[model samples]
Target chain A: MSVKQQELEKSWQQYKTQQRKKNLYYAFLTVLSVVVFLAIWEAVVRFQLVNVRHLPAPTVIFQTFIEKLHSTVPDGNTLGQNVIASLQVSLTGFFFAVLIGVPLGLLMGWFEPFDSFVRPLFELLRPVPPIAWIPVVVVFLGIGLKAKATIIFLTVFVSCVINSYAGIKLTSRTHINLMKTFGAGTWETFFKVGVPSAMPMVFTGLRVSIGSAWSTLVAAEMLAAKAGLGYMLQVGRGVGDARIVVLAMVTIAALGATLSALLNTLEAHTLKWKEMR
Target chain B: MENIAEKNIDTRPIKVEVKNLTKSFGDLLVLDNLNFNIRQNEFVCVVGPTGCGKTTFLNCLTRILEPTSGDLLINGESADPKKHNLSFVFQEPSIFPWATVEKNIACGLEVKRVPKDEIERRVDRILDLMGLRDVRKAYPKDLSVSTAQRVIIGRSFAMQPDLLLMDEPYGQMDIKMRYYLEDEVIRLWKELGSTVVFITHNIEEAVYLAERVLILSNKPAGIKEEVIIDLPHPRDITDPKFIEYRNYITDQIKWW
Candidate 1:
């Protein structure tokens, strides 16, 4: 082979080997840390270092989680059913928030009159946390799916609007001028240049909104809901079952992480252009 | 130069007419009562010292910034972007970062809602012309500086615009890249047969590309001299006559 070709091959091989080593090291550390954490937790509770009443052993929580997966536990529904129920409510609220918030924010940022009318109200309600609306939502909408969804919707909507609006406002002037010079009308410019430019920020809003939606699930289900992971947590706490509480917390965290990962994948696919940067 | 002007007089129709064009930002006057007429299909380069409102002149011509007291007529009518087919290649790389090279070139035709087949034909032609056929699928961020600028130029030319305004599109490129792209631009100009108003501060570049060089004075800019570049295509910078034209224009723009 030529010297340059040989050098290129050597560099490629080095890069592959370095990548493989990094991946293996990361995997080893992750597994080791998880094993160590579980062993410490199990030992602490099994040996009575901490009261079992307060913190159950990892084994006990795992067993409870497995049992709950098949059999109806505190909420008369299996763990899978509870998870689906929570997902249904959160997804509905999240989707609705994205649908309304994105356009509203884009209009508010793009159109002066629309901003004047909606900005004041948005600012006023923005400082008030989504959780604070729980009492008011429950009082008016009653203890049902609508009430729960509304609470989650409010939580996700604010983030979506803020991000979308900022994205639209921050669009580069050069792009706008270029579009205008090409005989693009206002609406055409908005769709072609404005909307596409705002995509990165819109996806950021979607990611943040999904996170908020998951977090607000517990408070949304604080009402007298029959089937959901949040409801299971409430009942577990009411009856003082530490195993059930731990199981629900772990499931919530796992589910939230999985949903966020899914959203992240979608974001990467949609905004593949950003990867070039 | 006199012979070329006489030759242009026989067949060239006035493409753009600027009468008493003046622009000011409140107390800061930028362009002061400038008047010039550009012939159809003429490659005119506007050159001046730094911050001499060369960009302002282009912007006012496109009506992006309205002239304070003057009229700009394209084909005997007021210039309106909405009514006219016009395109601008900005000094900075203005290729849409979100779009691939092919899509960036197709943007103007897409906005105009041209037929799909024609848009495809134009985009393909431009990609080949700009020598971007290999990297047509690559986004702006992945390309080299000259490639990105080529995409911008190709986009403007793909529209087959009646008039194309370029604001120092090669300002940031190195000497070698600039020469290559300048040659590419001349090729495109010849093939497309569009009127071009190229703005730059470089006198050598102006002499190298333009049939007519419109030299402007320092700030609150007005026409200082109009130099007719009679050099043939593929001009040699080392040619004595080429250096003469370059030096003559350089003398016109020297503020010091």
Candidate 2:
């Protein structure tokens, strides 16, 4: 090999080793911090610094968490069943919202007349929080899966529309003109140029919506759920079982993080053209 | 004097004709009654002071911005983007960031609904011509500024456009890269035999690449001068005749 090629190979090896070391360090820190936090919590409760009823010891919560995996909690359903119920409602609502919202937003952004008609209604509806819709949703659809999924759908749909609209609005004018020069018609330009350009923003919307969807699902479940993490929390609160409440909260957090991470992986795969963050 | 520049050129039929074209934005006039004819297969460069409506002129030609009063004809008919196979490279890098280099170059042909094999053939030829074959699978964000601009240019050429409009495509490049790309453009023009209307603010660039240079005055801009560059290809900057042509155009642009 030439001298320059050998030098490039050496640098590439050095870069790879450095990256690996950095990743290992980050992983170590993450685990150490979690361990320290759990230890501090366990120590404080064991020493009776705080009431164990209000704040259960980490070991107690972990024990309950394990026990609830198969055994019924106060709601008469296992932790696994609650989790599956929540996932089903949230994912179903989120899927439909994305399927409809992204295309509607793109069309509103691309055509002025469509924007004129929809933007006023959208603005009127945007500020009213999705949680505020719970009473109305209950009245219209009653206390069922439809009611809960509708709540999650409202939260996810707003974000999807806003981001997708902004994406299409901010599309570079030069790109549109370039499409025109290539003899592309309105629909062709929108589908080929506008849609693809809006993808990064659309994925960003999906991430934000999924996060909101999880939280909204919890709220909806707590209000009128028959089975889910939020229902478990509600039952725990009614019976004054702080361990179950804490367990439910932790489960909700972990599930939210996992789902968001999955969406992030999808975003990275689709938008590999973006500069790596 | 205008007739002098018109003499001794190949009698190729006129490809673009702009007659008394005037454009105004509200009360602000931009292009003031301009007329010009570009022959088929000619490489014409347009240069003017900054903000002299060079872009507006090209926009009018491409029907992106309609002229208030006048006509732009392509082969004796009004210019219609739908009917014409034209391409434009903007002042900024306009390659689709979502597409790979190869796909970006093929975008025009795809839009025109060319056959798959023909599209591949054209894309391969342009990739080879632009020296982008090695980086065909790379995205725009991964390439250097020069390579990105070359990809845009390659995209325009891949369409095999009847007339290609370029608006200072190398305006952001440093001098070395600009000159290199200018040579590449000239080589491509020779090879493809497509008419080009290259707009730039750089006089030396105009002299370097143009068969005839159209110099415009300040806004409301009009053609102030047209200089025919008779210099041979592979021109040298230090050549006395080349310097003379550059200085002659420079003197005409002294409207400050």
Candidate 3:
């Protein structure tokens, strides 16, 4: 290559390297912040700055976590069992919500008659909290995993519907016009222009729906789940064992964060064409 | 309803006919008995006094609005998007950001369900002609606005529609880019052999790009005059005859 061409290639390599380094630095900073925060908590506990009875050290929580992984102990189920129970219930409800809500939302937004028919009912129920439906679910599903899952489904379904609906509403008129001029049928226009245009918002709804799943998971499990993190929390509270309570909290937080991270990865892949974050 | 792609190709002497087209918004008359005809395989530009119901006329032609009276006919059939192969390039770039340069150009073809091999062939040819081959796989977000506009124009042309309507597509571009785009359009029109109706406010642009210019009168509008440009291929903008035609059209526009 000519010298100028070589220079450009060299600069491009440098730019990539610089970008990689920047990302690594940000990651390192995040790790450092969490580590520093954990150290302070450990110090406070060790020095008796806080009541040990009320709050446990990170080491104690970690030991309890390890023990709970293998032993059911007071909660009558192991950590793995509780996690599995929680995942099954939450994911069932969450997936059902997405399946029913997303298409419902898309159709409602696109078809005027559908929107007219569904809007009144949707708006009427939107304000009532999902937890308020726990009694209704219990009456129907009898407080088993089914009842718990139904509660989560309710919590998640609204956001999925609302976001995807708004996303479709945000579909560009220019695009629809373009499709019409191209002699596209209504269905063709909806799939090609309306659906793709609504995706970013749909994904936004998905993220919101996933979050609602976790937030409602605990409450749903509290409605008499035999094995779940939320059940463990209630049992720990009943027996005045703050350690198990904190353990359940930590596990839930960690699992929720992991799911959120996975969702973020999916969003990045799907919306690669979106300009800027 | 017939699918445009599957429709047996039918050619009529006049590709488009506007017969006493009238449009009124409640009581305000926007278009008043507009009448015109665009011949098959012809390039026609429509110029009018600003806000002379030009957009209403276009909207009527595209069936975006129901005209108060009269009708537009394409190939001896009532104008319907599903019944005829038609393409439109809007005043602004309307490229789909989700699609790549190649997919964006192939959108019209895909809509009409053209054969996959045929779609690919036409897309590649247009991508080369439009100088979009290098960025064929790149999405619209990564491209410049002008590049995005090229994708739009390329898409409209790639369909090789029976009728192509463009509404001031270069309105937002600089004069230099506008001229470049205008030349590309003229070349595409010549090669694709589609009847084109371009709407522009610029008299010079109408003169430069059109074989026939239909100048419209002030609001409550109708065609004022028809100026058929009798110039050689690749006509010089700086040529004396070209300037004379431009001046004459400009005067006609002012009078209207």
lDDT of each: 0.90, 0.92, 0.88
lDDT of 1 by residue, B1-256 (tens): 5565566442699998999999999999999999999988999999999999999999998878989999999999999988888999998667788889999999999988889999999999998888889898998878888788888999999988889999999988999999999999999999999999999988899999999999999998999988888778989999999988888888778899
Q: Individual DockQ of the candidates?
A: 0.70, 0.82, 0.66
Error of 1 at A269 (Å): 0.6
Worst 10 residues of 1 chain A by lDDT: A268-277
Of models 2 and 3, which has the larger TM-score?
A: 2
Name the runs in model 1 displaced over 4 angstroms.
A1-36, A46-48, B1-10
Better of 1 and 3 by lDDT: 1
Cα misplacement distance, residue A33 of candidate 3 (Å): 2.6
Local accuracy of candidate 3 as per-residue lDDT tens digits, A61-135? 999999998998888999999999999999999999999999999999999998999999999998999999988
How far in Å is the alpha carbon of A240 misplaced in model 2? 1.0
User: For every model shown, what is its TM-score relative to the native structure?
Assistant: 0.94, 0.96, 0.95
| Window of ten residues with lowest summed lDDT in model 1 chain B | B1-10
lDDT string for model 2 (B31-116, tens) is 99999999999999999999999999999888888899999888889988888889999997798999999999999898899999
In model 3, which regions exceed 4 Å deviation?
A1-7, B1-12
Q: What residue pairs are clashing in model 1?
A: none
Q: What is the DockQ (computed on Cα atoms) for candidate 2?
A: 0.82
